[model samples]
Target: MTIPEQIEAYLTSQPQAKRTDLRALHALMLQAIPGGKLWFEDGKNSEGKVVSNPSIGYGTRTTTYADGKTKEYYQAGLSANTSGISVYILGIADKAYLAETYGKTLGKATVTGYCIKFKKLADIDVEVLEAAVKDGVGMTGEN
Candidate 1:
Protein backbone atom coordinates (compact mmCIF):
# COMPACT_ATOMS: atom_id res chain seq x y z
CA MET A 1 0.00 0.00 0.00
CA THR A 2 1.07 3.59 -0.47
CA ILE A 3 2.10 5.85 2.39
CA PRO A 4 -1.17 7.73 2.36
CA GLU A 5 -3.15 4.51 2.27
CA GLN A 6 -1.15 3.06 5.14
CA ILE A 7 -1.72 6.23 7.10
CA GLU A 8 -5.43 6.09 6.39
CA ALA A 9 -5.59 2.46 7.43
CA TYR A 10 -3.74 3.20 10.64
CA LEU A 11 -6.07 6.04 11.51
CA THR A 12 -9.15 3.97 10.66
CA SER A 13 -8.00 1.14 12.85
CA GLN A 14 -8.26 3.30 15.92
CA PRO A 15 -11.33 3.63 18.12
CA GLN A 16 -13.75 6.36 17.07
CA ALA A 17 -12.44 9.10 19.34
CA LYS A 18 -8.81 8.22 18.78
CA ARG A 19 -9.39 8.07 15.05
CA THR A 20 -10.71 11.60 15.12
CA ASP A 21 -7.74 12.82 17.13
CA LEU A 22 -5.24 11.07 14.91
CA ARG A 23 -6.78 12.53 11.78
CA ALA A 24 -6.68 15.99 13.25
CA LEU A 25 -3.05 15.52 14.17
CA HIS A 26 -2.23 14.24 10.70
CA ALA A 27 -3.88 17.25 9.15
CA LEU A 28 -2.13 19.58 11.53
CA MET A 29 1.24 18.11 10.66
CA LEU A 30 0.57 18.45 6.97
CA GLN A 31 -0.35 22.11 7.29
CA ALA A 32 2.32 22.98 9.80
CA ILE A 33 5.16 21.35 7.90
CA PRO A 34 4.93 22.18 4.27
CA GLY A 35 6.73 20.27 1.51
CA GLY A 36 7.37 17.38 3.83
CA LYS A 37 7.56 13.74 2.84
CA LEU A 38 4.82 11.55 4.29
CA TRP A 39 5.78 8.20 5.76
CA PHE A 40 4.23 5.24 7.57
CA GLU A 41 6.38 2.79 9.48
CA ASP A 42 4.86 -0.60 10.23
CA GLY A 43 7.12 -0.96 13.29
CA LYS A 44 8.91 -3.90 11.81
CA ASN A 45 12.61 -4.63 11.78
CA SER A 46 14.55 -6.37 9.05
CA GLU A 47 13.06 -9.63 10.27
CA GLY A 48 9.53 -8.13 10.02
CA LYS A 49 8.90 -8.59 13.72
CA VAL A 50 7.03 -5.79 15.35
CA VAL A 51 9.32 -3.88 17.66
CA SER A 52 7.31 -0.72 18.12
CA ASN A 53 3.88 0.69 17.48
CA PRO A 54 3.11 1.55 13.86
CA SER A 55 3.68 5.26 13.32
CA ILE A 56 3.00 8.06 10.87
CA GLY A 57 6.01 10.16 10.00
CA TYR A 58 6.33 13.63 8.48
CA GLY A 59 9.23 15.53 6.96
CA THR A 60 12.79 14.19 6.86
CA ARG A 61 16.15 14.38 8.61
CA THR A 62 19.55 12.80 8.32
CA THR A 63 20.69 11.48 11.68
CA THR A 64 23.97 9.92 12.75
CA TYR A 65 23.66 7.18 15.31
CA ALA A 66 26.13 6.42 18.07
CA ASP A 67 27.56 3.65 15.96
CA GLY A 68 28.50 6.20 13.28
CA LYS A 69 25.82 5.17 10.86
CA THR A 70 23.77 7.89 9.29
CA LYS A 71 20.14 7.43 8.43
CA GLU A 72 17.47 9.46 6.77
CA TYR A 73 14.43 9.45 9.05
CA TYR A 74 11.29 11.37 9.78
CA GLN A 75 11.60 14.75 11.40
CA ALA A 76 8.36 14.18 13.31
CA GLY A 77 6.32 11.08 14.07
CA LEU A 78 2.86 10.21 15.45
CA SER A 79 1.59 6.99 16.88
CA ALA A 80 -1.17 5.54 19.06
CA ASN A 81 -0.22 3.47 22.06
CA THR A 82 -2.15 1.40 24.56
CA SER A 83 -2.14 4.27 27.05
CA GLY A 84 -2.09 7.30 24.80
CA ILE A 85 -0.84 8.90 21.59
CA SER A 86 2.79 9.79 20.96
CA VAL A 87 4.03 12.70 18.89
CA TYR A 88 7.73 12.62 18.19
CA ILE A 89 9.83 15.67 17.29
CA LEU A 90 13.09 14.27 16.18
CA GLY A 91 16.59 15.77 15.60
CA ILE A 92 16.53 18.27 18.43
CA ALA A 93 20.01 18.96 19.66
CA ASP A 94 18.97 19.89 23.16
CA LYS A 95 17.23 17.04 24.91
CA ALA A 96 15.32 19.38 27.23
CA TYR A 97 14.03 21.79 24.60
CA LEU A 98 10.59 20.30 24.03
CA ALA A 99 9.84 19.81 27.70
CA GLU A 100 11.17 23.21 28.60
CA THR A 101 9.47 25.15 25.83
CA TYR A 102 6.09 23.49 25.60
CA GLY A 103 5.60 21.21 28.57
CA LYS A 104 3.60 23.52 30.85
CA THR A 105 1.67 25.03 27.97
CA LEU A 106 0.86 21.68 26.40
CA GLY A 107 -1.79 21.05 29.03
CA LYS A 108 -2.14 17.36 29.93
CA ALA A 109 0.48 16.11 27.51
CA THR A 110 3.81 14.68 28.53
CA VAL A 111 6.74 16.34 26.79
CA THR A 112 10.02 14.50 26.80
CA GLY A 113 13.33 14.88 24.98
CA TYR A 114 11.72 14.41 21.59
CA CYS A 115 8.20 13.20 22.25
CA ILE A 116 4.88 14.59 23.36
CA LYS A 117 2.48 11.96 24.66
CA PHE A 118 -1.10 12.39 25.76
CA LYS A 119 -4.21 10.33 26.25
CA LYS A 120 -6.46 12.63 24.25
CA LEU A 121 -5.94 15.52 21.84
CA ALA A 122 -8.62 17.44 23.74
CA ASP A 123 -6.46 17.31 26.81
CA ILE A 124 -3.66 19.27 25.16
CA ASP A 125 -3.30 22.56 23.35
CA VAL A 126 -3.28 21.96 19.64
CA GLU A 127 -1.68 25.30 18.82
CA VAL A 128 1.19 24.57 21.16
CA LEU A 129 1.66 21.22 19.54
CA GLU A 130 1.70 22.87 16.15
CA ALA A 131 4.40 25.27 17.23
CA ALA A 132 6.53 22.43 18.48
CA VAL A 133 6.10 20.51 15.25
CA LYS A 134 7.04 23.51 13.17
CA ASP A 135 10.01 24.10 15.36
CA GLY A 136 11.06 20.51 14.91
CA VAL A 137 10.83 20.88 11.16
CA GLY A 138 12.89 24.03 11.24
CA MET A 139 15.47 22.48 13.48
CA THR A 140 15.87 19.64 11.05
CA GLY A 141 16.39 22.19 8.22
CA GLU A 142 13.35 20.90 6.40
CA ASN A 143 11.20 24.01 6.81
Candidate 2:
Protein backbone atom coordinates (compact mmCIF):
# COMPACT_ATOMS: atom_id res chain seq x y z
CA MET A 1 0.00 0.00 0.00
CA THR A 2 0.96 3.60 -0.44
CA ILE A 3 2.38 5.62 2.41
CA PRO A 4 -0.82 7.50 3.05
CA GLU A 5 -2.80 4.29 2.98
CA GLN A 6 -0.39 2.61 5.36
CA ILE A 7 -0.52 5.58 7.69
CA GLU A 8 -4.29 5.53 7.66
CA ALA A 9 -4.33 1.83 8.37
CA TYR A 10 -1.90 2.25 11.22
CA LEU A 11 -3.91 5.01 12.83
CA THR A 12 -7.15 3.10 12.33
CA SER A 13 -5.70 0.13 14.15
CA GLN A 14 -5.11 2.04 17.35
CA PRO A 15 -7.50 2.11 20.28
CA GLN A 16 -10.13 4.82 19.93
CA ALA A 17 -8.45 7.33 22.22
CA LYS A 18 -5.03 6.71 20.77
CA ARG A 19 -6.38 6.85 17.26
CA THR A 20 -7.82 10.26 17.91
CA ASP A 21 -4.61 11.51 19.45
CA LEU A 22 -2.53 10.13 16.60
CA ARG A 23 -4.76 11.81 14.06
CA ALA A 24 -4.39 15.12 15.84
CA LEU A 25 -0.62 14.70 15.97
CA HIS A 26 -0.58 13.84 12.27
CA ALA A 27 -2.36 17.06 11.47
CA LEU A 28 -0.06 19.03 13.73
CA MET A 29 3.03 17.57 12.06
CA LEU A 30 1.63 18.46 8.66
CA GLN A 31 1.19 22.02 9.80
CA ALA A 32 4.74 22.09 11.10
CA ILE A 33 6.21 20.87 7.82
CA PRO A 34 3.99 21.80 4.98
CA GLY A 35 4.41 19.52 1.96
CA GLY A 36 6.87 17.37 3.86
CA LYS A 37 7.42 13.77 2.81
CA LEU A 38 5.33 11.14 4.57
CA TRP A 39 6.25 7.60 5.56
CA PHE A 40 4.80 4.51 7.18
CA GLU A 41 6.71 1.54 8.49
CA ASP A 42 4.87 -1.65 9.32
CA GLY A 43 7.63 -2.52 11.82
CA LYS A 44 8.87 -5.56 10.01
CA ASN A 45 12.32 -6.90 9.38
CA SER A 46 13.58 -8.43 6.14
CA GLU A 47 12.12 -11.71 7.32
CA GLY A 48 8.77 -9.96 7.87
CA LYS A 49 8.88 -10.53 11.58
CA VAL A 50 7.32 -7.80 13.69
CA VAL A 51 10.19 -5.83 15.17
CA SER A 52 8.51 -2.69 16.46
CA ASN A 53 5.27 -0.81 16.59
CA PRO A 54 4.02 0.58 13.30
CA SER A 55 5.00 4.19 12.80
CA ILE A 56 3.88 7.16 10.72
CA GLY A 57 6.70 9.44 9.72
CA TYR A 58 7.12 12.92 8.25
CA GLY A 59 9.80 14.96 6.53
CA THR A 60 13.25 13.71 5.49
CA ARG A 61 16.85 13.79 6.61
CA THR A 62 20.10 12.31 5.37
CA THR A 63 22.03 10.77 8.25
CA THR A 64 25.78 10.22 7.89
CA TYR A 65 27.44 7.72 10.17
CA ALA A 66 31.01 7.86 11.50
CA ASP A 67 31.86 5.09 9.05
CA GLY A 68 30.84 7.47 6.22
CA LYS A 69 27.70 5.55 5.43
CA THR A 70 24.57 7.64 4.94
CA LYS A 71 20.88 6.98 5.03
CA GLU A 72 17.83 9.00 4.19
CA TYR A 73 15.22 8.75 6.92
CA TYR A 74 12.23 10.55 8.31
CA GLN A 75 12.83 13.70 10.29
CA ALA A 76 9.96 13.00 12.63
CA GLY A 77 7.86 10.00 13.53
CA LEU A 78 4.67 9.09 15.47
CA SER A 79 3.67 5.78 16.93
CA ALA A 80 1.30 4.21 19.44
CA ASN A 81 2.56 1.86 22.11
CA THR A 82 0.92 -0.32 24.74
CA SER A 83 1.37 2.37 27.38
CA GLY A 84 1.25 5.51 25.29
CA ILE A 85 2.25 7.38 22.14
CA SER A 86 5.72 8.43 21.02
CA VAL A 87 6.80 11.37 18.95
CA TYR A 88 10.24 11.02 17.46
CA ILE A 89 12.22 14.06 16.39
CA LEU A 90 15.07 12.59 14.43
CA GLY A 91 18.39 13.98 13.22
CA ILE A 92 19.15 16.19 16.16
CA ALA A 93 22.86 16.73 16.58
CA ASP A 94 22.82 17.40 20.30
CA LYS A 95 21.62 14.34 22.16
CA ALA A 96 20.75 16.43 25.21
CA TYR A 97 18.69 19.02 23.37
CA LEU A 98 15.24 17.50 23.62
CA ALA A 99 15.46 16.57 27.27
CA GLU A 100 17.15 19.79 28.24
CA THR A 101 14.82 22.02 26.29
CA TYR A 102 11.51 20.26 26.46
CA GLY A 103 11.66 17.67 29.20
CA LYS A 104 10.19 19.87 31.89
CA THR A 105 8.09 22.17 29.75
CA LEU A 106 6.42 19.43 27.75
CA GLY A 107 4.11 18.65 30.66
CA LYS A 108 3.82 15.05 31.74
CA ALA A 109 5.68 13.64 28.80
CA THR A 110 9.06 11.97 28.86
CA VAL A 111 11.52 13.76 26.69
CA THR A 112 14.58 11.85 25.62
CA GLY A 113 17.36 12.42 23.12
CA TYR A 114 15.05 12.18 20.15
CA CYS A 115 11.69 11.06 21.44
CA ILE A 116 8.84 12.62 23.40
CA LYS A 117 6.51 10.02 24.84
CA PHE A 118 3.23 10.48 26.68
CA LYS A 119 0.19 8.52 27.57
CA LYS A 120 -2.18 10.84 25.73
CA LEU A 121 -2.45 14.23 24.11
CA ALA A 122 -4.25 15.58 27.15
CA ASP A 123 -1.30 14.73 29.29
CA ILE A 124 0.98 17.24 27.60
CA ASP A 125 1.04 20.74 26.25
CA VAL A 126 0.37 20.49 22.56
CA GLU A 127 1.97 23.86 21.95
CA VAL A 128 5.22 22.79 23.59
CA LEU A 129 5.18 19.63 21.60
CA GLU A 130 4.66 21.66 18.45
CA ALA A 131 7.61 23.85 19.31
CA ALA A 132 9.79 20.78 19.84
CA VAL A 133 8.71 19.39 16.49
CA LYS A 134 9.34 22.70 14.81
CA ASP A 135 12.78 22.89 16.31
CA GLY A 136 13.50 19.36 15.21
CA VAL A 137 12.41 20.03 11.65
CA GLY A 138 14.34 23.27 11.58
CA MET A 139 17.46 21.62 12.97
CA THR A 140 17.41 19.12 10.13
CA GLY A 141 16.73 21.89 7.55
CA GLU A 142 13.71 19.90 6.49
CA ASN A 143 11.09 22.55 7.12
- The candidate that wins on TM-score is 2
lDDT of each: 0.92, 0.91
Q: Per-residue lDDT for 7 in model 1?
A: 93
Tens-digit lDDT track of model 1 for 30-76: 99877789989999999999999999999888888899999888999
Per residue, candidate 2 scores C-alpha lDDT tens digits across 42-131 of 999999999999888888899899999998889999999989999999989899999999888889988889999999999999999999
Cα error, residue 114 of model 2, in Å, equals 0.3
TM-scores for every candidate against the unseen true structure: 0.95, 0.96
lDDT of 1: 0.92
Clashing pairs in 2: none
Q: After superposition, how far is residue 43 of candidate 2 from its true place, in Å?
A: 0.5
Query: Which portions of model 1 miss their true places by more than 4 Å?
Result: 66-68
